[model samples]
Target: MNSPQTINGLMRHLRNDCKIQISGSYQKQQLTSYGYYHGYKGYRFAGNSYRQIPYSDFSEVVAVIEYDNNLKAALYPELMFIETALKNIVCNESVKGLKLGTFEHLYKERMSDNTTNTKLQSKRLKLRNSVYAKLAARYHDEEEKENQMVRHFYNRGEDAPIWVVFEILYLSDLAGFFECLNEAVRENILKQMNMFDISIDANKNLLSIMIYTLKALRNSVAHNNIIFDTRFKDRKISPVLKKWVEKETGIQNITLYSLIDYIIIVCCLLKRVDFSGTRALTLLNKYKEENQRLQNSVASEIYDHIIQNNVPAKVVGLEAYLNV
Candidate 1:
């Protein structure tokens, strides 16, 4: 193990070991506030520690850190809105087919994939058990941590409504429920959302897949993980999904490897789900301004790596798409 070092020691390490020009009380204050481990260690590398980013100054690193913080601030509330909207949609559809919206009823009538293939059926059964296990553990005892709403349902010895049930699940767990839901319910959920890809009679499962895919970014933003490099992106962007985005927005290559790509995804979803008629544009403009702010704060090369040149064009394409 290595010896523990003070913030100043970390600063010296940055200057000597990392070959970055970091000095002065202002930079020292930044290192102290953001931390040598979390902020600098995170920003110094591109995707991994081995591949160091071409940062010549501590200010550039600070710029990236600040940009990431701002990006998370900008994206998180919209993410929450989208997640809640999805939950409501799923709940509505799950209940529509049943007189009683009990979890069991939803499980049988709506949640199961109803496949005949043995392997798929086995996987479904295991997943069903997992969901039951998770819910059972959460609702097990009358602890103070449990909410009144949950306690009310539990006290009655009645299963919680599918809506309440979904409210408690993590986004990924919610994705599981969505993935297993009957095709019609999934299609209807997407239809109700007015989702661009799913409602068009194509990519019905895209909604769930999107929930699963975007969950990584959601988790990162929620937890204050690094966003400037987009290393938090967990899954490969599907070509089908990319093509849908590209075809719809007229953006040529939807790599989803840049921060702007996520903005595009959010904008696409927002355009459909946002009722105010101005929220998506507001977000887009905010993103453009933020990117420009980053550009002004850092070297052009650093800004290019962070924001990508295609971002401006993509933003234009997205705005045009939203206007349509």
Candidate 2:
């Protein structure tokens, strides 16, 4: 078992074993403030923890830590807004458009009942079962006592409404439901999301695909996980989705490789939610200033690993779109 060490001991280990030059009058205080596990270990790599970042000095670690802290501060509110907006939009659209608000109605009427396509039918059955399991757990598990929604439904002796179900679902769960929705319903939701267009109408899955792509960053930022290197990106981004962003913003090579691409996604979503382009522009400029701050604080190579060359073009293109 590894022995626990004090801050001084950790600094010694970094110096002697890790060979990192960590020396400053205030570094110990900084270490104390952020802690060894979250501040240093969290910043020790780029993209993956196994791939150790080339940190020649302690200041670089400090730079990364500060950048992450500032990023979370900047993004937390925005994430919350996007999450609530998406849920509200989806729930309202589904209930009003379909003229059905109950879970069972939506599930039975909206889901595929085709016996000819066994695979799709089976897939949909599984999705239905998954939702049932989640609902059962929520109502019967310890959540019944602790969760107000569960308790409310528990007391009523009535099935939880679809809106109530939507309230409890995580963004990932919401994405699953969206993906399984009937094409017309899904496309209508996409139109309400302001993501409606010919390509989306053609490849209707793009809406849910986008939600899945955004899920990682949303969950990570909400949990205060590292994002500067976009290490939280855990899923495959479809080429069609990338092309859509490129077409919308007139920016080429819309790789979700850096943090700025995330901002672009958020900006697009914000636009969909009736937020002015000015608000997104504010976020972009804040990100730009944060980049400059980190650049001034960290080594160039480390900064380059997190922010790529195409980022400036992405920023400019997005800025132009917002300005328009």
Candidate 3:
């Protein structure tokens, strides 16, 4: 374990060891306010591995941190809304023919068919068992005693309803649950959620893609991870949705793999769910405002680096879309 250091010691390390030029007390004040580990170290990763930064300036690092903070603030509410909407829709559709809280319902109707690929079946069973184990722990634990829904079910000698259990599930857990369901059931849920214009096959494919993408975005936003330049490696974009985004933004190369594409996808989802999308629009505007200073600063190179690695057209198109 490394020895702990005070703020003054950290400031010295930044100036001497890191060779970063500090601008008097203001930078120190920021260090004190946001902490060296979270504020400095988090933004430091944006720099090259050699710890060399543009102009060797500490202010650029501060600018990057502020930009990320604004992004997190702008994204959290919209992502939360999307997560809640998906959970409610999926839970309602999944519990149709069975009692609310029984594992049998999931095994019979929701779990993947065992007759299919043996490896896939084993994987699904593992995921399902993990989820049930988590649920069981929560049910038995007093940690959730104050949760009114849990209390209500416990008092009545009944298991919590599907919706209630869903309340405890993380967005990633919800995505796994969606994946474990039969394709037809997934399509039915999507259709009920106002995705009916597409063919059943297309809808199934789109839902799988969206669930995977949204799960990545939701985890990033919820965990205060950097959102502006995220490129989801595991998510596969639906070609139909990609085409729609390209058409809407008039950007031919909108790949739906970066943060900008994710935002556009969320907007599309909001429209499908009969939401006005005002919050999403507001978030875009906020991001635009917060991002401008960094775009003009040395940190712009960092953004450019991420763009080079991902899709530059989508990143630039998102700014254009927000301005419009």
Candidate 4:
């Protein structure tokens, strides 16, 4: 017979302790706590006054581990990469494609040379107007100010390409992730696809598969969707992937992760593109200060828990991909 048990104060300790070693060997210790307000029938593991259902409900605990790792693992890397890329993109003067003279009027002589006020202001206005107009049209009863602005701009309008929009939102972060890896890994990826094969059809097919893979991962992260264990959001087949696998691995229907893995391999083969290693840590610190400076209750709580626990940081650096 199994006795019912409940866990109340376990979360605090689990978070503060970086690692837990049990027995003679050590494994990554992750604490998953579930609270049932009214305890129900079950068996539970008791430690340090905290109770955990022993997971006897399943044949194994692998499923639970997979679920946790996938969502958190995939998301953190994707998020961290994207954040770093955006920062780099914004800070990198070359990418902005602007001349130093353009910013001279905005700040004092020394400061003015590096300013981005004009472009940033334009971007801010465009975003604000676009958002305000859409909302006003949908909810406001009276004639909206947006109508006047639209008439002023005339009939022509250009919407930025969806892909470009996604990139702009998180450019520096993505760049940082892509930049950090070694070149050998990337060449291995290209080699894996047999891009140098004698047949033109084979080369084309490999290229197509590579493009599709990057695009899919791009879409998932750009849209703020869950990454680890993501159901391929777009199932459009890549003939290149199908053909190459059929010829080489004798398989079809490769996964989205497989494709991104290929891109990562390619990135690694290029000359090393390490960011100032401090960027990630810097961002986390900035986030903490901003939350405190603003006195944002929720942000402060998240900052304390996430930074103190390092859950998000660990997830971003998924150890599995370390050597790759």
- By summed lDDT, the worst window of 10 consecutive residues in model 1 runs over 194-203
Report the candidate with higher lDDT, 1 versus 3.
Answer: 1
Q: What digit string (tens of lDDT, one per residue) describes model 2 on residues 237-308?
A: 687788788788888876787788888888887777745545576678888888899899878888887678
Residues 111-197, candidate 1: write the lDDT tens digits: 556577675567557667876776767666446674665667877988777766876778987787777777778777776776546
Clashes of 1: 0
- lDDT (CA) per prediction: 0.78, 0.79, 0.67, 0.33
The candidate that wins on TM-score is: 1
Candidate 1 vs 4: which has more lDDT = 1
Per candidate, the number of residue pairs that clash is 0, 0, 0, 21
Tens digit of per-residue lDDT, candidate 3, span 177-247: 77677776777886786554353245354555676777777776677766655633455566765665566
Comparison by TM-score, 2 against 4, better one: 2
Total clashing pairs in model 3: 0
Which scores greater on TM-score, model 1 or model 2? 1
Angstrom error of the Cα, residue 82, model 2: value is: 1.4
RMSD of each: 2.3, 2.6, 4.2, 17.5
Candidate 2 lDDT (Cα, 0 to 1):
0.79
